[model samples]
Target: MTGVLIPGPGKRVTLRDVALEAGVSIKTVSRVVNGEPAVNAATAVRVAGVVERLGYRPNELARSLKG
Candidate 1:
């Protein structure tokens, strides 16, 4: 699963990638990553697992721009 999700050595895993791998929407993956309480336990756990497996991370530059 990890091998399947990782783009390459230089490529960083994106949230959208996690969502696709987890079979959830981007918004749902975002909610989980942000540690929002809107997502249920089961979904959150599943998303978290995918996050870890894919080494997915929110882009700091993107976060800064959004902020």
Candidate 2:
């Protein structure tokens, strides 16, 4: 299942993991994942690569609640 791809005990790759792997802050990873402008191209690429490799799936409902 998709859950197996996630690094967590369940099916979720937390922002912290992506940040650690990408060598960036959680905020930066958030910006890249949320498609926010201002992130550098290289940084975005790195974050995206990590996301793809880790099969990270952002929780849209959580983001909407925060927004």
Candidate 3:
């Protein structure tokens, strides 16, 4: 059963990683991910690009808490 070890479901790209990749802060990533009005359009685009590249998925439970 030996094979290449793949990152299983337990592995996830967090907001911190997105922020780091986008050269922004965690709060900025959170704001962009949540579609907050405060985020600049350009910044949002940048964050979104990083999110897509990194395959970052926000946690639904955390999203609900913001509502």
Candidate 4:
């Protein structure tokens, strides 16, 4: 898959992009995206906003590998 973080015509946005845009660590973005407990609600909300704005989506293959 392409490494592009900004989704455009046929491009897939990534977690790293969300983190960078959200001004948080990648792990924090992961936690927020995965619905993991312990993330601050405010932070999660911020990350979610960035995700929506950036059109970010988790790579399913990488997600499965993480599990």
Q: Score every model by TM-score.
A: 0.87, 0.78, 0.74, 0.76
Model 3: pairs clashing at backbone N, Cα or C within 3 Å: none
Residue 17, candidate 4: C-alpha displacement in angstroms: 0.6
Model 4, total clashes: 0
Query: Could you tell me which residue pairs clash in candidate 4?
Result: none
Counting clashing residue pairs in each candidate, in order, gives 0, 0, 0, 0
Q: Order the candidates by lDDT, highest first.
A: 1, 2, 4, 3
Query: What digit string (tens of lDDT, one per residue) describes model 4 on residues 1-67?
Result: 1233565687777778788788888999989988998799899998898888887877889878987
- Please, what is the whole-model Cα lDDT of each candidate in the order they appear? 0.86, 0.83, 0.80, 0.80
Task: List where candidate 4 sits over 4 angstroms from the true fold.
Answer: 1-8
Q: What's the CA error at residue 24 for candidate 2, in Å?
A: 0.3
Q: Which ten residues in a row have the lowest lDDT in candidate 1?
A: 1-10
Following a full C-alpha superposition, what root-mean-square deviation does model 4 have from the true structure? 5.0
lDDT of 3 by residue, 1-67 (tens): 1221333577988887777778888999989987898988999998898888778887889778987
Best by TM-score: 1
Candidate 1 lDDT over 1-67, as tens digits, reads 3335479899998887898888888999999999899998999999999998888877889899996
Cα error, residue 24 of model 1, in Å, equals 0.4
Model 4 gets an lDDT of 0.80
